[model samples]
Target: MVVQRLQAAALLLGPLIFALSPFFWVDGHYGITGGTLIALSMVPWVYGLIGEYERLRERVPTLAGLWLLLLVIGMFGSIAFGLQGFFEGVFDITERVSLAALDEYPPHSLFLLWLPGPSFPLALLAFGVLLGWTRMAPRWVAVLVCLAAVAFPLARVLRTDWVAYIADLLMVLAFGLLAWRAWHRPVAAATSD
Candidate 1:
């Protein structure tokens, strides 16, 4: 009971914190505060993912495994990306200089930024589809998750505040529904395993 409520809270708060992070940005950079928030947001996101995996694993073990793997990779990459702001802010390094330094280390850049960065949205998109396929969530909720998954990456890559806000709103709506359901209904009763 307590665990479910906590998970629900995490789902509700994670994206909200992420959405608030943009307000902390300074001079086109997230800086320490914003970066901290972004990094912190991942904690709940990870928890939510784990909880979700536990819920779905029995029904689709292989697919759940793949989803968990992708989510972990994506979160790791996101953490590194978020920490860049912290490091830069702490050391007073310019974005160009930081990027250049990363460029000098091709493997680091590839694993930390390029490869895993894109995986997050891809994983989310997969999760959305899986939800509909498995009937774990409503069709509308799954569609919203897919839409948010697509919009999130675009908003981040483009650095568009409005788009980001839209993505965040979508996430809150979709995930919040899931969270609410989780809180109100036990998974065992919600699905037939």
Candidate 2:
């Protein structure tokens, strides 16, 4: 019961925090405050993702497991990215200099940034589809989740605040609905899976 509540809280809060982060961005850069929020958001986001896996695992064990794995990998990459922003803000490092330094380490760059980065959105896309397929959520919820998944990567890559905001809003709505359902569900039903 406690775990369910925690997961629900995480689901609601994680994306909310992340959505608010852009408000802290200054001069086209995530300052220390924004970076910190991004990093912190990942903690609850991870918990929420785990809870999502738990819900889906009984219906589709293999796909759920893969989604969880991908999400975790992508989370590590996100954390690294957030920390880089924090450090850059603290040290007054330019984006060009930071990218140049990171380029010097090909393996680190590939594993930490490039490879795992896409996994987050990809996993979300799969999760959204699975939610609809398994009848775990409404069709509109699934659609919103998929939209958010696609928007997330594009928002970051394009550095578009409006798109990011939209993605964040979609995430909040979709996850918020899931959390509400989880919270209101009978204990037996929640545990049965």
Cα misplacement distance, residue 49 of candidate 2 (Å): 2.1
Q: lDDT (CA) for every model shown?
A: 0.82, 0.81
Residue ranges of candidate 2 with Cα displaced over 4 Å: 189-193
**Pairs with steric clashes in candidate 2:** none
Total clashes for model 2: 0
Candidate 1 deviant stretches above 4 angstroms = 187-193
Residue lDDT tens for model 1, 162-188: 776787788878888878877786655
Candidate 2 C-alpha lDDT tens digits along 54-117: 8799899998888888888888877777777788899999878988998999998999888887
* Candidate of highest lDDT: 1
**Steric overlap count per candidate:** 0, 0
- At residue 154, candidate 2 shows an lDDT of 82
